[model samples]
Structure formats: C-alpha cells, structure tokens
Target: MTNPRFDVAGIGNAIVDVLTQTDDAFLEREGLAKGAMTLVDEAQAAAVYDKAGPAMECSGGSAANTIAVMARLGAKCAFMGKVKDDAFGRIFGHDIRSLGVHFDTAAAADGPATANCLVLVTPDAQRTMLTYLGASIHLKPADVDLGVIKDARVTYLEGYLWDPEDAKQAFRTAAAAARDAGREVALSL
Candidate 1:
C-alpha cells in the first residue's frame, strides 16, 4: 500500500565461495566431475578444500550475488538466508552488509557450520563446483521476514532454495507476502 522501501528482496542459500585455480589433472585426481556442480557433505567439502591450492574466499550464491550487485548499483536491497554463528557465517553477513544489502536472518547456534562452495577453475575457465549446503539448508518459514517482503518492490527467489524443504517453505512464504502486498515476484531458474 505504501511506497516500497527496497527495490528487491532476495532469498537463497548463504554460501562462502572458495575459489582456486586448478588444472584438469587436478580435477581428475580428485575424482571431481569436470565443470559440474556437485552437492557434497561437510566432511567431503573440507577434504576438497584442504587439498585445494591457494584460494580466494568471498560471499556467494545466486540470489545473494544478485542482491549484492543490485545494492552496488545503488538499488536498495534486502536478503534472507541461513548461516551459522561461525567464521564463514560472519564473513557472509559482514560481506553482504558491507555491500549495503539488508540481511538479518538469525544464525543457528547449534547446527552445522556455514555453507561453502568450492569452485575449481581450470585453465580453460571451466568451473567445477562442490557445494556443501550445511546451515544454509536450515532456512525455515520463520526466517522469512514478512515486513521486508511486503516493503520490497520485487521478491526474488532462487531455484537452489527448492532443494531443502524448509527453505522451500520459506520461499513460498516470501512469495505469498510479496503477492499480498501487490509486489512483484521473480524466480531464478
């Protein structure tokens, strides 16, 4: 009813990306599917990360990246995603907030650690990804802020959120709130 306060509200997995340069031989040695994104567990993720070469880490995710870019472009944006009260979680929160994106989802106190995506970039610029959903999959409907959704001109949902039932419900809740407020809903496939 009132003027929207934010241009976009995004919801998706909260992930810290660890990127490393590797060769095809490294991928083959690690038994990684070349240029494919694979879902892995925490231990597996750690194992791969331990073996990776010098790397760079940063906040990353489909919707989160979109929101970050929108904020950088001077659009008021808000983001909702799950994270743990761990190092990576702190980095994620700090990175998004520093970019001027509003993010206030509570961190899980006792669950798994924050999520991370290991992106192995080969010489040809092909990316082989190993993603550990971790705490990001713990997002539930309660994490969806109705006020933010209702106050944003558009609510964007990422397809990755559908992988987790709870996150899926949160996405639905956000979509409903935006629709009820006469706001637009966008989905990233």
Candidate 2:
C-alpha cells in the first residue's frame, strides 16, 4: 500500500459546454425539447452550433464538474477522461488543470473533436442540452490510471460513461482499483 496522493479520482466524459441564452420561441424554432438532454451527432452538433447565438464555452461534464468543484474546495483530485488534440480538447484539459486538479489523460491525435454540449438556458432558468460525445467516448480501460485510482481516497464515476463500452470499462477499472485499495467509490447518476 502507498500513501494516497489525491483525495478523489474522477472518471467521466470530458465535455466542453457551449452555453447560450435563448427564448422559448428559439427553442421551438430549433425543434429542441426544452429541459431535456438529447444526444447529437457531429453534423447535428454543427447545425445546432450554427443556429445558436453567441455562446460561452466552458469545461463541463457530470463527474468532471464534480472533480473541479472538489478541487476548488481544496480537495486533491485527479481526473481521467478522453479528449482530442483539438481546440476544445486543449481548452478542456487546460481548464481542469488550471483548477489544480491532476488530469494526465492523453489526447487522441486522430479522432473526433472534443465533446460539446450545447446548453440553451431559457428565461425560466431551464436548460436544454444537445451533446456530441466526440472523442470523449473514446475513453478506454487503458486510460484509467491504476496508480491514481489506488492512491485516491475516493473514486467518482459518472453514469453517462455507460453509453460507451470503452468508457464503461475504464470506469469499472477505476472503481475496482479503488475498491482493492480499500477506498470509496461514488457514482453520480
């Protein structure tokens, strides 16, 4: 057994959120079901991005956000997820790292771009999400760093990762490592 190096290790989708403010009319015009998350392909993502007005891009995802918040609260955390060597990917990696969270997952050189979530917030404060999984879906068991998992006091997992077989394997690996180390594993549904 080794000394824990991190308070938590998170495994989940690495997504970049493109938030935009819109009205019900705009949501209806875009054929979006308000307040629901819909998965989109690359072409659909492009169409939505084109239709959306000015947007604010930020690093986001279920467990990813959890790790960022935990780190901000002064908890040592490590994040494991996949991204591409593209603009959004770079930004996502940089944002998490800048927050003092350890993220050493390798970026895919040749693949889809980083995942993008088009979050449309309406006047009622309700959000509608359109997501393109992109390279984040490429996360595999190999990306799960056993050392980081075992060295963390807890491992956090996101249920969204279940959509991808590889990512699901990575999540299981991390959880197993944490369990073997007698650490806690938390799942965010």
Candidate 3:
C-alpha cells in the first residue's frame, strides 16, 4: 500500500537565519564567539540583531536546511517542527509548502514568537549561529505525528533541537515511530 504521507519528513527548529558578513574584529568587539551554534534568549537575539548590520533573512533550521536542499534536488519532503503562528513562522511554513513539502505541525498560537537565528558569516566564509528557540521549544512527543512517520521514506533530525528537554523527548519519540514504520532515520550534527 502506498503511504499517503510523504517521502521525506524532518523535525527541527523553524528559524529565520539572519546572515551578514563581518570581520574578525567585529566578532571580538561584539563579544561574540565564532563558529559555534550558541543558544540564546529573546533579549540576546534582539541584542545581536541591534549590533548586526544589514542582513538577509533566510529560512533555516539544521534539518530544515537539509530538507530544503533535498527538495531543491527534487526529493519529496515533509517537515514537522514547532513555530509561533506569527509572521515569521507563517513565512517559513509557506516557503516549505511552496517547495511541495508537507507540513502539518501545529503552531503555538500563544507562546514566544517563532525562532530566529543570527548567522555571522566571516570573510573566510565561516558561519557562527546564535539562536533563540522561542515557540519552537514547545515541541514535545505529543507534537509528533505518527502518520508522517509511516509515509516518509526518511525521517531527518538535527542535534540542536536537543536544547530544550521537551524537544529532546519529541525527537526520541519521532525516531522511534519512524523505526517502527521501517523508515530510515538520518541524524546530523
């Protein structure tokens, strides 16, 4: 029986990556660390943005990024991740759907805003990320969909999602569900 779900499903953060090019002195002056994904709170997110110059907002999240590329390569895809039902979240959801990926994860209608990341790209092209999980932290085992697991050929995940304990639990549940469905589970650091 053909599963009526999808070929690829990913569960991770739903973030808008703000990328900007800077020099080494810029990082030191701003008290920012380099080349690591640092978890931040909303205030820190704001602080980073206030300091950063012009940036380009791109739809991103570790697993989400991989799924996006896979989709661009024409792989059938689906993504399950939490987001605030606010503007940024809506835009991320729309972008994925436009690429023909299935997304049915419920958005947190009354929590923190959608997640956002500050991506500082140096002249050397090395990237450092500071993230605020925001509403994406609400992801729990209950948020995972068993049907998506059944239909997808691969279930992909990102390690960064483990920042919040609930989300970590959700990842475990999703992986177990995918295993039960005989689907491949891919994990990326």
Q: For model 3, how does the per-residue alpha-carbon lDDT over 1-189 read when each residue is reduced to its tens digit?
A: 466366688998888778888888888897888888888999988887898889987778888888888888988888888888887788888887888878889888787989988889998999988888888778889888888877888888888787789988898898898888788888878
Per-residue accuracy of model 2 over 129-186 as CA lDDT, tens digit each: 9999999989999988898999999898988888777888888888888888999999
Error of 2 at 88 (Å): 1.0
TM per candidate comes to 0.94, 0.93, 0.84
Which segments of candidate 1 are over 4 A away from where they belong?
none
Ranking 1 against 2 by TM-score, winner: 1
RMSD of each: 1.3, 1.5, 2.4
lDDT computed for candidate 2: 0.91
Q: What does the lDDT read for residue 118 in candidate 3?
A: 86
TM-score for candidate 1, please give it. Answer: 0.94
The TM-score leader among the candidates is 1
User: Which prediction has more favorable lDDT, 1 or 2?
Assistant: 1
Best by lDDT: 1
Residue 155, candidate 2: Cα error in Å is: 1.2
In terms of lDDT, the poorest run of 10 residues in model 1 is: 160-169
lDDT value, residue 35 of candidate 3: 88
TM-score of 2: 0.93
After superposing candidate 3 on the true structure, give the runs of residues whose Cα lies further than 4 Å from its correct spot.
1-5, 23-25, 34-36
Model 3, 98: alpha-carbon shift in Å? 2.4
- On the 0 to 100 scale, the lDDT of residue 66 in model 2 is 92
